[model samples]
Target: MANDTGREAVKTVPETAGEDQQVQERIRKQIASELNLPQAKVKTTVTLLDEGNTIPFIARYRKEMTGELDENELRSIEERLQYLRSLEDRKKEVLRLIDEQGKLTADLKASIEKAGKLQEVEDLYRPYRQKRKTRASVAKERGLEPLAGWILSQPRRGSVLEEAAKYVNAAKEVPTAEDAVQGAMDILAESIADDPKVRAWVRRHTQDHGIVVTAAKNKEQESVYEMYYEYSEPVKRLPPHRTLAINRGEREDVLKVNLDVPADKIHEFIARQYIRGDSAAKETLQAVIADAYKRLIAPAVEREVRGLLTEQAEEHAIRIFAENLRNLLLQPPVKGKVALGVDPAYRTGCKLAVVDETGKLLEIAVTYPTPPNNKVAEAKAKFRQLIDKYRVELIVIGNGTASRETEQFVADLLKELGRPELQYIIVSEAGASVYSASKLAQGEFPDLDVAERSAISIARRMQDPLAELVKIDPKSIGVGQYQHDVTQKRLEESLGAVVESAVNHVGVDLNTASPSLLGYVAGVNGTIAKNIVAYREENGKFTDRKQLLKVPRLGAKAYEQCVGFLRISGGKNPLDGTPIHPESYGVVDSLFQELRLEREQLGTAQLKARLQEQQPEELAPQLGVGVPTLRDILDSLQRPGRDPREELPPPIFRTDVLKLEDLAPGMELHGTVRNVIDFGAFVDIGIKNDGLVHISQLSDRYVKHPMDVVSVGDTVTVWVLGVDEKKGRVSLTMKKP
Candidate 1:
């Protein structure tokens, strides 16, 4: 029976062994089709996933078994596999519930089995789904169900009134034939509404042709949702951004939203399906159809349509967030430089931190260069002292409050110092405060205040974005659109996957990585990560990857999954720094012998050239490994200890900051993409406010999404389209036109 939750609490029937195999086969086929991968490959990947291998580990180490599916594809397979398994369980439960009712039919069972989505299964079982007291239930209780069935059959010989008259009984509360007919019609109305095929057809028609209309609650009030106040768009054509905007507006009580469905078309379609003849009861049946649609079907269809739209929008938002986070995390680290980090403020004074080439804090200070207390000379003197003392090569300024004034101050200070070689970059200080106040930050810097810790974070982020950014929450990074609006659980999972993928792709330095960074490694949880760090601190730098097995709570399984992604430079084994796993050491040794090279010469240019000359297919036979593995080994040999992010463009550095007023239409400038959303991208062009490049201006041709053209940390050339000085907003266009 249906509970308050509106779902039937069915007793689960365990699937037979054969049924389980069928379910697995069905899932494999679905995943293969969805991912455009071979069925065999999907089967292998699923087996690896079921065996507890992480996506990164499977993608990197088990390429031969899984046909070389990348991390993204493997993630997709995993998500779909989980959904399919849940779908199968629900299908079994639904089938069992229907069978127990003694009402399950061959056609109905077939329909349930063929159902692709949970909604379809629910619709097929809607007739038997227990519900609260309704008009239909009241008619059934009044003994009018027989008359309702007669009316539905629409026999040519009998008069509908005569059949309905026989159902009238005083004891049953049917006082007259008219009352009996009305009661019967109520039951028939609900039956028509409950028909699975009828509901599916109506849902599909409405979703294809319906229009979503939104109007402001108060026309006079201005809001961020003003554009959606009088909007009407086809449901099929509505973009994810507009749907999310409309949903947000409705949630905020600023807009009234409704669906404009084709009621007349829906009525005609139902008539053709349920109406059997031009009998005397045709008018009565037509009235019942209208009632059923308006009272039962239309409202439910509208809700389903809205839910589908919301699910799509949420998925899109999550995908965008994940992509932006990946790009932001993979931003090229500025290595081998001493930087002075500034956390700008007005009343509190700007907090300063100086770090050497390795991001170790050398000094901390405070200066008032902006607002009520503009101690320009004092700030300049302090900056000169720090730069000279630490031999600082770059200034890393947090793009937060009072950043413009701070930039002006730094530019002036640089001129006085005559440091032409020194440049400054405006790094996104998003979540810097959150990280500063975190317990991890306090543990790292017990003597530093929040602002001082934030200053150090900014400096370190510029030096190594991935290492520092992982310490904070991905949601707080500010690279997403509608992040707070999406399902928090799903958003966190997706973003976490992105972080894991990025960390594994760029193997972590075992000696230097913090627990937060290590926690993202494959097979390493927070506890294990902390234990690894503790062990490292107690034992000094790890001399080999094998030592991870000795760390408490880190056993053979954890070491197997994580060792390949953890790099130990100048370790006992030269191959440890590369992605080559410990199990593959024999293959590497054989390859070195074949090439007449020593293990110490592995990363040399000479060895790389020699490895490049050998074909992977030919070498695989000799190495007794798959061609994919051999190719990967060759790649690692060619570029040992290489950072994948170094291939991307570096962040833009500025000697001077530009004011919003400085921008002119058609003026071209190079900018770094700060954040990308569905509608547009925000580009940092050395200005106080980042400029917006709408999706239309993203390219000379049509753009489907901003991410398709650019990603966070990408450098692109854009021309100023317009500037709003009053609002401190700048419009930019990547296209020449």
Candidate 2:
């Protein structure tokens, strides 16, 4: 029943609280089931997130509240929760808009309310969305809507043309019966095209049956995308990487891509859905159905299909990049070593910086070890003098221009110097240049040149990878597949999360952390991090955790969120240095009283043994804390100021370098995983170019993804599968004979 006023009454959510709660409960249950989490975990986690708790805080400190959900799991719930909530908001808006037009039926409202996917909801609302000067709108303006409806009824009594003749008015642009009939058909075609059920069916059918076909614009052109020059794959079988590759090629005008589907099937489905028995309007309606599918429906569905595929590909690519970045950032730190850093170059001469154990810039030197200036003897004498005088323990080389030659020089020098402890490592200086020219770097070292800053960065990075790497943009770290091809906002958000998780995991040193590392701590933004640094400089070092409150704009709430992750060694309270929150000091004191242990005994071997012997499951109730939290506290007390990265294996430092010509098929060598991608892992085997371990060769067993076998910073033994000296290609395999 249409309202005369052309509007229907709508209930505000405040008036529908009970119904709103029911919808929320459904959303909670759906998210829990979809994520394979306990319903209680979902409920508790959502509540914590809603209260503005950061993921790192919840994941690290509130383990009991979230059932010990890790950062990744918590983030997944957060994403899905946001999507479901946004979907709810969109559903309400759609219902209100449809009601404003007085067309909100019970069935339509129910269908829209029950829709799970955003696409499904959009499909249902497509019919009610206002049109923008379409052929159908033009036909309706010409007053042929009634004739279109009559034609849709498909009555056996009257002819379509005869019925259309009555609406033939020249003033409205309907010149004759044929013109009116054509206009009526246009209206019918658009209506059929907009039907939600028809679009939904066609979308699913095309996705399941369509073929992604691509052909080169110039068949003989040579490019990196040659594999996709003449490619055809079933839509369901296409991988994310290949989809992005073909899309990039098509964008660059190197390829023509199309989604191929059977047009006849769509026309047939439209016929069976909107038409009934053999009747008078069947002839006119049949042509309209074909026109609708061919003109309106097919192109639209193709775009939707392509868009969905692209969205999925981009999401997967971002996830992979995030994972790789996490692994790279968490590479174990090489602590307490005086390092000599070399930013390798030719004509500019290798820029050198010496950093003390505390990462202070000690000295800067430039030596031409590589050609354009073959001052090898002079370079060796200067390096030897520096090493002896400063007692430098490690040589860190940037894996950039002239790196191989630099490595060779350092190797020969170390051999001549006869220092068994002096070894060098090649680190990916991926974003070192970006950091060197950054404002943060400029403020940090005002007098230093960009190359000097880069050398210092490389040195500090090898000593403490997490601390130094956090200073650069995660995207510039370059452990990504098609990173530039995906949406940048999303990529930055994901990589930032990864960096945040890594920073909080290690728990930055309050006095020593740079502004870059401090910025990523939970609840601390860029401005607050800088203010804290400013406060520290004006005052002395923070003696206790409470001093954080004195920093500008760092309120009680921010302190509560960030304090647990900020450790102050040699603070007023010994517990301040541990991971245990100050709020739990009562439980710690009680535990100490029960165990008869002194606070000074923290980090002692006796304390570790005692803490390890006591069962957390048994002591949790007595301690008045949850088991997870109590266990964490015990571990923290046992090793105050613990760095999580300390537990992992350290990077390999080679005393000698190998040449690409030295590699042969079946030769065995160990390498560090520089980057992991969808197709394979790039292994740095002490050569100019890193070698590739293809996904199929990563293991002898069946592997679905390369990440399943290896990750960035992994040290594994790889056998040379082949070597191309002219092309500078080294193909390696993890599988051994």
Candidate 3:
């Protein structure tokens, strides 16, 4: 609480535009309700970073204080707090500026204080703000202010210019009736632009209704902006990927992007704020206001609104990327076996690689199969020999060019051979090519061609998705929604965290983990991961988790954070294979003594059943540990050497892949949901293009979001209501048939 960073230390200070203590109380209560924290414990003085409250630490412990908040909720709270604090700072700065201009009235002060949002505060301060030289300045220079005010007075039904000529016959400017009116209109336009309330109203309306325009520059200007030449779409409808692409295009001078709102719609509000008389001069005032809107306010508002829209778009894109990365990392691994991968191509034939159980490539080959120039019979003979010679149990086929044709060939061969013991998996080859050509991939497969390496990668993907995926750049994974549009740093950080958390949760097998897989473990990196693997190979199997200390550059702090998450299966102590941290090994030992059983007597399945009967709260006091820790210990004890990823539903598999033409309306079938978008989710029913399950049709009841019920890779039951193969689109519903 002391001056830790040379900043003022305060307690429960509510600094915001809203002076009403009631508003602050309501928001505080909302936070309390969401976090499940008591009102008293939810004091404003409590910083998220207060000594005992790191995000992960508070989320894991202090469940009562935070109402059982998970890591996601905790992160949301942190973000919201930062945003609210920024809004408060901006409000204070705006108030100070208005007061400095000496135009701060009691009414204005009250308006600013009662403002519920940042936009409202900005509106009230607009009239007093400093700006660049504009049309109003030019009109004032021409000595037209007197004539403009006279028009607003609306003197009964005479030519306003005739009246203005008498007072505005200045030698400085406005020599003719037309010139006088033009000068007056300029002043009125500037005044309408200055009106604070009008600006606020227009801003809100624009946000709700604005649509950005993306277009290539004119043909004559094609040399300047070529990339955006064919672009056209509503801003609201533009996906994350397109938004990023267009933004990058504009940034690099390849496109012209403009954000627009209905000028007529915005002008109506300005007219209401400024035009208020019923005479010829009143008509003149309206005309001037219209001009002002065209010449000044519209352009400025467009720029401001466009900036805000871009920011919102970027944030949404970043969040989507983060979510996809999390799910991908948490996907289940097949685990523990070597695989043979095939990267198929036409001219170069299909590249093949045989990898050992540890995923080290032992051999590589090329075969002509299902190609522009087919050698189907010869290719089949060669493949059959390789399968037998290498003792391969699983065959991985990359879902790439000529894949379906290759699949047909493989299926025919399998039926003829009739070996039910052998299985084959179709792997998504989304980022295989990208990884094979990357510097890291080159270093790993130095002696092999990129295509051959890609084949090996496809095989390994089936064996362990998370482990193999970590080696490739996540951006190229193809599961992301508008991935290219998100902020690069935020996308990387979030994905990296997801990978780390998933790796630690599953607890890697120290003896066999590759550097890529081990790098994602908590408190471990490429160098340390490689060192551990090398040391294990030199010294033989790890007898105890404590032996990790022998690895070079791995310190005590690293071991403490990581050892609990790394399980050594088939090790000396049964507890070592469980998630129970070594620090709590003493408590575990005591629990065994109290239960009148030896360590050797405990079996995973039996212990799980016993713990359900004897709950943790009843055991916490006896064990002399916190109830939270006791609960974690009990959960871990039951699932010794558990792979967390294996808990999720398995990926949907296809047999004799069907086309859209094969389906009928109201036909109920199991399908895998491939991707989720704002409009709805796309389900792959083994058709050419995935079918859309519109948000409205996602549930029988009102469904607000597709994600509420479905996620990418979910095996769901969907009814195909319509299919338009010609249009390459399909419609599906989640309703029961």
Across residues 638-683, which tens digit of lDDT does each residue of candidate 1 receive?
9999999999988888887687777899999999999999889999
**What would the per-residue lDDT of candidate 3 be over residues 1-737, giving only the tens digit for each residue?**
00111011111223444455564565456556766666555542234333223344345435556656666766666555545555656777888888887888888887876775677777777777786787667778888888888887777778886876764555766677777777777777777777777776776776667666777655457453465676566555666545666777777666788766777866667767666756777777767767776777778777777666666767766666666666666666666655668887888888888887767777888888776768988888877888788777677888788766666666677776677756665667889999899877887888888898899889888777877887887778777776666667677756665566556656777767777777766556567777888898899988789899999967775565566666787788888888787888899888877776567755655666776666678888888887777888777776666777788887554334465678888988777776676668878676555689998889988776677888776779999888787897889999876
Which tens-of-lDDT digit does each residue in 233-321 have in candidate 2?
Answer: 98888999998998899999999999999888888888889889899999899999999988999899999999999999999999999
**What TM-score against the true fold does each predicted structure earn?**
0.95, 0.96, 0.76
Over the full model, what C-alpha lDDT does candidate 3 score relative to the true structure?
A: 0.70
| Stretch of 10 with least lDDT, candidate 2 | 1-10
Better of 1 and 3 by lDDT: 1
Task: Order the candidate numbers by TM-score, best to worst.
Answer: 2, 1, 3
Determine the backbone clash count of candidate 3: 3
Give stretches of model 3 more than 4 Å off. 1-58, 61-65, 88-130, 137-196, 207-288, 302-325, 485-501, 504-564, 570-576, 598-606, 652-670, 684-703, 717-737
Q: Which ten residues in a row have the lowest lDDT in candidate 1?
A: 1-10
Q: Predicted candidate 2: what Cα RMSD to the true structure?
A: 5.9
